[model samples]
Target chain A: MATLKDVAKLAGLTTSTVSRVINNRGYISENTRKKVDDAMKDLNYHPNEAARSLRMKSTNTIGLIVPHVSHPYFAEMISNLEARAYEKGYKILLCNSQCIHEREEEYIRMCINHKVAGIILCSGSVALDVFDGVDVPVITIERFLDNRTASIECDNKQGGALAAEKLIECGCKHLLHVGNIGTLSMPADMRTEGFREVCERKKIPFVEIYTEDTQYYRMEYDEMLENVLQKYPETDGMFVNSDVIAAQTLQTCRKFHISVPDQLKIIGFDDTNIAQLTTPQLTTIHQPVKEMAEIAINLLNDSVAGKLVAKRTVLPVNLIERETT
Target chain B: MATLKDVAKLAGLTTSTVSRVINNRGYISENTRKKVDDAMKDLNYHPNEAARSLRMKSTNTIGLIVPHVSHPYFAEMISNLEARAYEKGYKILLCNSQCIHEREEEYIRMCINHKVAGIILCSGSVALDVFDGVDVPVITIERFLDNRTASIECDNKQGGALAAEKLIECGCKHLLHVGNIGTLSMPADMRTEGFREVCERKKIPFVEIYTEDTQYYRMEYDEMLENVLQKYPETDGMFVNSDVIAAQTLQTCRKFHISVPDQLKIIGFDDTNIAQLTTPQLTTIHQPVKEMAEIAINLLNDSVAGKLVAKRTVLPVNLIERETT
Candidate 1:
């Protein structure tokens, strides 16, 4: 195992200064910290946990709790988060909770027990009881609760408004909204509220189709889309829940001969890679994932450094016009 | 910091039995081992590495090296490999080698220094000269590197033959195969060779498009597919290299009024999830990913457990005909 002595030798720093930098004590300059961390990563050195505990105390690592890393949305979010966190010189230990809220709560407790610098929660926004109990700094994504700590998210209301306005401008008179909105999820509420407000403002008639349950992410969604299209044959424009749903909706539309942007103008949210790979492509709302991830990591860094984090960090959203709308 | 004593106490076992079970040294029964491991996982018990080193002297973890996990081909492979490895009681530490020879070399060295039980080389069919120096068991996927250790893969030539046969059955006459054929890679050669040989048997003229260098993996393939269609207006069949390329081709066909299976018959290799999600769906060769992954992990585990590995395991492939054919 490489020690502080070897790291100091490689970083060209005195043992005391290396200790100061690693420990975040003795008022060491920022340059020394970079040199020390670069040397450590190069050396593939993991400081002894007990020894570091006795010396500097914290490992400066943050744990990110995501439901699944393989899903497109979470994968894109994690890629952005990883890039931003790597730029900030923090190593991320990603835990795939796999939608088990109890498992997510366990990981949170585990990170706290391991003295992780901070925690970023992205899995379940419905469970506030667990997050409220967390004593350490917690950064959230796409949801906020009780004005605790920090959160970075795109303006979901603005995103929903953009989708509504685009579909309206595309001459979609008979409109329908398809989504799963059974829970008190903040982002969902914001989006639906903005959508309803826009419809009221325009005095356009619209119908909302809520998916079966609050737990509906992507399981059995292709069937649900088929049913929605079959039930609403006269619907001209549909603002489906996500890009995944929008892609499936387009497939269903083709099955029923509802030509897109002519007979039907469809819009989705998230603007993930799946949106681009669609045949006509997707005119969806773009969540500033990279910027939000960067902000989340920055807030975690600040909180870990014993600085105050902003109550809410709001990023902008934009409408990406492709072939769908 | 729960130790063997805590775990054994919780599981109603002696510390020595728990230690033996964890180390896999002595003849502890399976029932006892299962009980001990369950208790450990339940109580978040992590074993002492140094203590295990003094006894068995090997970390019971394997390193899985892949090019990128975001790609559907490798992502499906990783999922299969992880499930197989986890079933065999081995934790996989993923290393994304980015398909660079230097990165592969570096990760091999990293795996060695970390004393992982074995390494599963998925991306790079590493040169024998590079791995001959490493003092660990290596399992290479998708290759038959003769005179080396164990290798397990699906039959690529048979898969290619099936693809050609499917397209031919769809009444495709003027067809083209898009892939690579060179001294460096064997899979692409096998596929193209199988395709050409079949076309020769049928006395049908065929065109070949090759991807140069690492461009086969990520080459902005939509434009390439469009260019191919533009060049070969009479072409009615496509034997794509992978499922991703096939998906892109399938999506591109919709733009030109070229209906899949009606005007053009397309066959994709690697029956990944994307194959089922495509609009017309895909008739592709299923490369027994689960069986191949299980055999690879089995070879690695058998080698690490001081048992002889089955040399040059070959699994079968099948053509799944869906709407595309």
Candidate 2:
């Protein structure tokens, strides 16, 4: 229940100016409008008029914000989510953030303006501050944003440890970890920590490499993988953040005449469709993607229905042994 | 420009009943609402009230309907389309049809209700009849719905023929063409036709196989590919419908101990990210996905501006040789 006064105070602006921005009645510059909008979002302030109208009607739609649907992981998640949401008589408003911060913020504002019943944020780059004043119910996937918002995530730490153990069990001497550029912001970074801990416990040597490019596409991953292999030719075990990257790593290994399993054992996270498509089918961590998607939709529905839901729901992950290992 | 009278006439209902459904002003039954909505859609009936209000203010949004974002081809298309649309100061409201007829129809109605400036339909399952009374501008991708609606597609026939020629040039004896169940609806079906034509002209024997399941997910595709390989053990050259399937074909080949390019020279359409991810990088038809996406968005914008856009805009496709063939 943040008020316009609170928004004005947070933005350091006059109440009248905030009201004008809310009504869109005055000649306001783009900067002022953005500041006001940002303040309102930070305050999670809902204009009384909009809030009352939104309550009076049911939109039967939920907003979904993902980094990019073109990415296999998000695409599969969205597919399962949309099907489940449709079964429950709701449609999804898909917002592709494309890993762009400003676009992600814009989509959040648009979702509120359109009166979506709730929002599901799958984009990890979005900062927690942006959700400070969001009025609608939010369910975050994989990323922990706030103490109030509900989040559903697979056990990244456990999965990473499982990968490390499996690779070690295969007698892989040297290990390598490939991570994303913005790795620290995401809870998935727990995977790297888990791997490191397991390697240290086993007294095995390991090297870590991260791509300079963003996580939205996998093209740059192959180049980075090549550089890593060149720098650390003895790397016999590799743990990639995603199956997409692992697939690229496999392709790069083929070019270098590196034999899989015999010479190197590779494990990937998120056993998506691409995992099986790899030459020596990827031995990877299998997250309950469909189940997680179903739970996310239900959580949104529960929040929309004013039910008290858990703030964090962590699902278990398992290792799937395939030809690569 | 269709009137309420036309919709009422088409639905064999009174104007008042149709008006009630349109405005949601009365307690209308689900059956009656559906009939009224269907009739309005059939007549391409633009509700005058919605049109008038929409013209007064720009919505800055466009509706995009695809079979499913999980499908790599569509996912990439959406990624490019959204980026281009954003550059043009517009946002996309994504609708995933999931090959459900009713869902596709419902999304159309929802888009109309949202007052989107235009729509881009990439779902092949959507019937041409549904667009009869669509009020907003529409640009179809790959599917040619009507004379009035604009469409963007790659040269599927040329791409298919190229696959046939490449496989033949690689000294393959037998050939197979894998297709989707809804082949007739999509212009991409021309790939199959072209492959067949080239095979016949070259005096090469070929077989065609199609999955009964829809094209959204690859589970059925794997099953179908297994059955195809089992039935057609002598299949040496294959021209699959998409790179996703090509990747699957490679995986299945591995399971059956059939080496690609040596035992079976294979080519696929839509050289997506997964194409390169495969070990023997897919030798396939490369459609200008990004350019096509940009054109589709521009066509929608043109239509929204009442500009004379072409009915069909076919982009060229090229064969990119890698390791498979």
Candidate 3:
């Protein structure tokens, strides 16, 4: 087996420099890093990460627990996080908790056992006690577990307000907001609150309906949305908390023979791929998914390095105007 | 730190039994496993995976490299793969290559250096030499790198033929097939072959159009699709290789004022979330993604255990008929 010395000799670098590059330590230029990487590849030399991690007491791995990646939002988030983590010489240990609290707890325990550098929790579980004894840095996305846990989330409240404002500006008289039902308070619930606040201030009569957790998991809201449309026949505008639900709303509108933008203007949160794929393409509140992911990874990295990071990060959202409005 | 002996004493089991459960080396009953797990959790005992992996010469980690998880198809695939791997006591190191060959190679080398038990390559890279000196077992999904490499793929040819037949049965006159362009031959190329054979047999006039790699990466085919639709104005039935492209075709049809299921029928591949989220709910060829993932993991496990495994396993596909048909 080739050693670090062989790789250094091949790359025309010192042993210490090669070691620093291998461990991803302080300041290595990109050109020099590339040279070392190529030399390591050419020599088929692989520094045993197990031994190195044992000595350093941490692996170049980050644990990312998400409810599920099948959702376009989380899917895109994972793509961005994984890419960013890789650029930082870190690998992501992916955990799909499927919104199960026990599963989420198990994954956290597993990450701790593996001595991951940090954990990024996006599972939507409100159980704050899961991180009771975890020593690793924990950064959350969209879910604020406790006061101490670092979180990176988009401006969901502003997103909601933006959607409501867009609908009203499009000549909507009676407005409706569809949101998910949660037992405990979550940062995402602010979306509904912001929408409600905007509607009240604007003096626009609006109704709110919450879908059960089952609907969110199954990614089906056609029946609930159809029922909402039936109950509120005068609803001229709708703002859904998620693009998936909003897309279903569009289908429901088609089923009821209601034309979008003409009869019922609609807006959705989480400008995921579904927003663009829908016919009359959905107008939506665009969450900075990539930016949030990058920030979350950086925060986790900083926290792992014993650098102080802000407890909360809220990036702004944008109103994406499309055919729906 | 709580020692293994303490955990064994707390669980009322021998240290050897606790070690067995921790290492996942030998069979243990569910009741005993639960007891050990509970006792460890109560004691806050975390078995150092780095030390264990060093002793065993392999870590309980599987490197999963996909083109991009942002794509709903790969997203769902990663979800299934991660869930199944976790069930088998393995963590997934997610690497999204974005279809970049150099990045894919780098990730592969990193996985090897990290001593992953196996690698699941879902990236659509055809470079055969990248795996020349890889010591770990590699299982490719959807791409066949070489004859010796193990691969788990869906019956692309059958999927293609099914879509073609479904479109023909829907009373479409002229047929159009949209596929991706690739320099090297791949198992996915069989999809086009199957479609071509069915068209030749049916004596249906069909035209094939290929999208560039850039389009695939960008996940946008609007302009190319629009051009195709304009050039082939007589085409009424379309079969797109992916749901993303098919969704774009739907948008293009809407742009052209072409009514679906009335003036045209479209069938999509992969049956991802996009298929269902589309306004008309795309009819698609459903690849058994979960089953394929499960099989691939099991095959990798078997290979790692020095058990005989098949070189190629092709699962069947089903045509999901929806509003588009």
Give a tens-digit lDDT track for model 2, residues A64-138.
888877888888898898888876656677887866777787677666656667899988567665555456788
Per-residue lDDT of model 3, residues A233-292, tens digit only: 999999988898888888899989999879999899889988989988999999999999
- Candidate 1 vs candidate 3, DockQ winner: 3
In order of appearance, the predictions have TM-scores of 0.78, 0.81, 0.96
Please list the Cα RMSD from the true structure of every candidate, rounded to 1 decimal place.
Answer: 5.6, 16.2, 1.8
lDDT of 1 by residue, B1-325 (tens): 6777899998999988887776666577778977996787667675544334324445555767776656666766766776676556565556666566666665665565445678888766677655554556788787545455587778877877888887887788898888763435754468887788888998878898876545554535787889989999999999987877888887789888898788999889888766766677778888888788888888888787788888788788898888888
Task: Write model 1 residue lDDT over A1-325, tens digit each, in one string.
Answer: 6788888999998888877765556566668888987786666564433345334344445677776555556666765775576456454545656566666665665565445567888876635655443456789898655656887777878877888888888888888987555653656557777788898899878888786533343334777777777887889898876776787777787777889878889898888767766667888888888788888998888887789778887788888999987
lDDT of 2 by residue, B1-325 (tens): 6788888888888999987776545388878977886785565454533233334433556888887677789889988998898766576777888666777776776676566678898875566666655568888888767754688889989988898889888899899998656544678778888888888999999998875545444444777789889998999998888888898889889889999878998898898888888878899899999999999888887777778888889999999998898
- Residue B300 error for model 3, in Å? 1.7
Q: Which prediction has the highest lDDT against the true structure?
A: 3
Highest TM-score model number: 3
Cand. 2 TM to true fold: 0.81
Give, for candidate 1 chain A, the lowest lDDT window spanning 10 residues: A48-57
2 or 3, greater by TM-score: 3
Docking quality tier of model 1:
incorrect
Model 2 chain A: which ten-residue window has the lowest total lDDT? A48-57
Worst 10-residue lDDT window, candidate 3 chain B: B179-188
Model 3 share of native interface contacts? 0.94
